[model samples]
Target: MSWLLDESHLADLSRGATLLGTGGGGDPYIGRLLVAEAIKEHGPITVLDPDEVDDDLFVIPTAMMGAPTVMVEKIPRGTEPVLALRTLEAHLGRTAQATMPIECGGLNSMIPLLVAARAGLPIIDADGMGRAFPELQMETFSVYGVHASPMVVAGDRHETVIVDTGDDDVRMERLSRACAIQFGGAALIAEYAMTGADVKRVAIPRTLSLGIGAGRAIREAREEHRDPFAALAEFFAGTIYQNVRPLFRGKVSDVERRTVGGFTRGGCTVAGFDGGELELRFQNEHLLALRDGEPVCVVPDLICVLDDTSAEPITTESLRYGQRVVVLGISTPPIMRTPEALAVFGPAAFGLEQPFVPVEELVSERFSEPVAV
Candidate 1:
């Protein structure tokens, strides 16, 4: 059923999206503020459940593309996403009936709301990735063979650039990232303009609800004086997210970071109170995780680091030495574990020289057989 989006929903969505971000997607704070401002100016946004969308309605998936750290310095003009959407619609010769997130994490999760509220369109409760990935092509849409061409890129300093990269999603990502650099490290994008039927078939279903539920679960746990991380694990039990488990709890012992080619790349070491240590590597998002030098988790799966006491997520850009943290991992969706999907987002794709192992397989003692959705 379709529902209304209000500030409370945005708050939970921000929190849940941050956790689901898997230590990337940029902070949700700025996006949340933009969304709140848009709502106040234009009134509540109508959020359409994916199933209720008309099959022929044109849905535009949108997000901010570039370095998350850079975005903090260059605030959006608020018109960028709307402009990108309109540009894409013009390029496609059709008007968008709705807006949807490319991923349900951080800025990308809330960006579609800004577009929806400004454009007077309903936002869909779905996304390409149930969680976030650093690369644009690493999504369910591409896994299902959706063409990511004919995208629109817009920013405060550049003319809107329309892209048509044929069947190469990777090339499209390269072109978009370059545009982000030219536009001063971040740009708003509207891409994968598809019919509603296409979205229903390829998008991760009800991810918005999943994020909201996660946020609410965490908040409610805090209110009731319970363990928030425990609440998160329990809540994921009934969601499409599978085999959720806390991987490690430690204090940051080291960080090696740099910004290269408009992306944040680095690794951090967390030393447990028990004297062991875990390592996490990232390129914009947490991609590889190791427990005492053994490969414990890899990409396509999720590796989320959170505040030890508050359960707030720590994105790669914000990770620093001396912060107490909890590391959690969850199995990627079954659809994302196929051979084709793995080829795009597996550990090898990240240039890591290790075999891709499912999080469930890596730590079977921490996971049960996932319930069929």
Candidate 2:
């Protein structure tokens, strides 16, 4: 079913996207403002369920690529995403039937809303990843063999680059990252153009609804003074997530952030009230979470660091010392947990020496429900 997305649901959308962002997808504030303004000008945007898309319809996924920190400093010209999409369409000699987000992360999630509204096309309610990952090649589309090329990277200054890497997803990412840095640290990517059939085959379906529901659950809990974390967990309990539990709750004891290799790389230590500690590693998105030097959670799964009191998500770039937080461990969607998917984005892929372990297994006692093996 298709539905109208107007100002009424924007808050839930923002909150939900942030939750799925898994600690880094840029802040949703900028994107929300952009989207609201666009809707004001363009009327309410229609969101199509992935199932509603016809097999041959063109669907272009859109995202803002590069350092999230830099994006905040150099605000978009508001034309970047539409330019990227139109440029891609001009290259392919076809018009996009709809737009999709590469992932349901914070900023990326809302970027597509503006694009779809401006283009007068519906936005798909699905995404490549159920949560966010740091790299272009980490999306479920890439894992399922969708080429990243025929991609368009549009800069804030109105410059655009069309990439035709001919099957090298990593090289496409490298070139795009370099261009984004050269363009002053931010660029909008409209890529992975594909038919609806491919989307149905590879995409993590219904994530928009997932985000909306999660956000609503959290908001209602807060409004009712119920345990927001428990409400959030309960929401996930009905989803495909294998585990939805807090890994740890603590005050940040230390943080080290650095811009390296065109990526935000850093780690933080959180001191538990009982004197225990948890450490998190990241390259833009939270990748690993450990307790006392032992691996409790690793990438390809989600390790969301959220505000302990309000349950608001805390992205990697925003981590600061002394802030109380609850680290959430959520299993990746079933598509991302498969053997083939694991080979591309599992623990080893991120330089971790250990094998990928399900978050449920890692925190057996936290979840009352039977954890999927």
TM per candidate comes to 0.96, 0.96
Candidate 2 local lDDT, 1-373, one digit each (tens): 8888898788988898887887778888888999999999999988888887899988999989877777666779788999999999999999998999998987888899989888898999999878877788777898898888889999877899998888888789888988888888879999999899998998998888888888898899999998787888788888877468678888999999988766788899999976789999988888889988888888878898889889988888888888999888887778998888887778777887878888888877553453211
Clashes of each: 0, 0
- Per-residue C-alpha lDDT of model 1 across residues 208-265, encoded as one tens digit per residue: 8888998898889888998887788788888778577667888999998887898888
- Candidate 1 worst ten-residue window by lDDT: 364-373
Q: Candidate 1: where is the Cα deviation over 4 Å? A: 365-373
Clashing pairs in 2: none
Residue-level lDDT for 52 in candidate 2: 72
Measured by C-alpha RMSD in angstroms, how accurate is candidate 2?
2.3
lDDT at 298, model 2: 82
- Position 309, candidate 1: lDDT: 79
